[model samples]
Target: MKKFTVLELLSLELKEHNDLDLKCIAGRKGLARKIEVPNVNRPGLALSGFFESFAYNRIQIFGRGEHAYLKKLEKEKKSENIKKIFTFDIPCAIFTHNLMPTKDFLDAAEEAGCAVLQTSLPSANFTARILRVLNDIFAAREVVHGVLIEVFGIGVLLTGESGVGKSETALELIERGHRLVADDAVEIRCVGGNYLMGMGANKMLGHHMEIRGLGIINITHLFGVGSIRDEKRIELVVNLEIWDSNKQYDRLGAQKKTKEILGVRLPCVDIPIKPGRNIPILIETAAMNERLKQLGVHSSREFNEQVMRWLESENVRNIYFHNNSI
Candidate 1:
């Protein structure tokens, strides 16, 4: 993880609901201060003259209550605790609901070189949004060589050796009304330690494909905007390899296989590629099958169980007939 500074947070180009709507109010020099943690602390206790377990490293959030309390304190000319709170190495202070801190607080923050930011969003909403943004920034991530596509509403990652027709198959899938998440290098991150989310490594190069003979092509322009997605939760992985005649493949599908990335395991399938084999169709079917598995419909296991039941019934009838005849 690289250094995430307060300036970077301010410069984030989030839109609409996810936007923080933040602007610097004071201490511009401390914009380069590193935000060490993803959490925020409300300095109500510390503002009330108690600093026994004050979390000074976290970004301090001054909501309406904290702001009003500061007003009350300033009315009585009590500036000791306000000055004392800034004595520690705090990352920054954010006043939510467009609330502005008093002059004493701002002066104390400026003197301590602590950045002060203001947002129009209420305290709860801003807290939720910032926490989500921070969690994504600090999540475990990995980059793998593959094409990520969304087939039948399932996120599928295509992985194989170079020249395995991954991009081509993805192109076909896109033509078939499926959406492409990324091409070539897919950046995968483990979100919430339960699911994997994948997207393009670079946003500027989004929805672009580099074919062997086609050079570079834009999927959004060629297929339209509906064919491209910014990101998706990776639900399945398909490994396409050259068809090996000598290699035994899992025809029954009873043996489940998975691939681990960033501490999260995803359902995996190995599709053997050969001349005249429709790789895109195979991948699409794999995606649908994965969806079925998620719905508790294990086709292979159910088929195997049914076969065992039939065999047991045939053996029981045979033994009874033999005993009666004897």
Candidate 2:
């Protein structure tokens, strides 16, 4: 239950949604209004005096059709419907395509303490873009310390203790042409209750990484833009740790381990760190294997089944040979 104020929504730093061009036209007093829902309402039926199930909590959008109806009602001296529409505790009113509400409508909004917003984008475009922004704002989020990278189109998160060399392995992956999503602190958000999206906690330091001895280096500047990505959907979680000679590790990939974040279970793999071992290549293979699993091809399970079938055939062959000789 994240509360996003109308003022903060206005000053969103999303670069892709610059076309919204939103500004407060009137009723600045209601800028503190709370926007709870991620969706917006057209209010066409409500403006026509049909108030059944009106979503009062959502931001009301006045598109081209709604704007025309408002102007017609103003001209016909029918201000009762306009007054009725503002009776609810609406968060704000937005007019798209630079369409301005009539004097009567604006006055109704002002009297009811509703913020009126204007956007230069067309009605459909504005509606689509604003919905996307609100969806991200309302998504469930949590921060984790890790390095996220995209290898062979799969998002892999490398996480471990303080001196586990996650950043160093990420640097090697970038050198191999993999894209780096985030370093150090990764902000993860659960999108649509199904997926986890990971990105850098700070946009300013997104492309920068810190190695133990070398300090900080910029991946984008060093490897060009192709080696960096803004964010990625984390599909696998690989935990790296120091090699323990006394402990036995899973060699057949039969042990299925998962780490849950925001209620989504991500496949987990533990890689032991030892001198002379290629961790970056192991991570890349893990990513590719995950992609194959998603396509309904489980190499480990298939191998296990093949081995079982071979043993059964060998037993049958030995029994037949003994019976024929007898």
Model 2 C-alpha lDDT per residue in residues 1-326, reported as the tens digit of each score = 88888998888876765447899999888899999899999899998889999998999999899999999998899999889988898999999989989999999989988899999999889888988788788999999999999999999999999889999999999999999999999999998899999999999776999999999998989999999999899999999999999989999998999999999999999999999999999999999999999999999999999999999999999999999999
After aligning candidate 1 to the native by TM-score, how far in Å is the CA of 212 from where it should be? 1.2
Those runs of model 2 whose alpha carbons end farther than 4 Å from true positions after fitting are none
State each candidate's clash count.
0, 0
Cα lDDT tens digits, model 1, 62-152, are 9999999999999999999999988898889999999878999989988988899999999999999998888788888888999999999
Give the Å error, residue 271, model 1: 0.7
Angstrom error at residue 275, model 1 = 1.3
| Estimated TM-score for each candidate | 0.97, 0.93
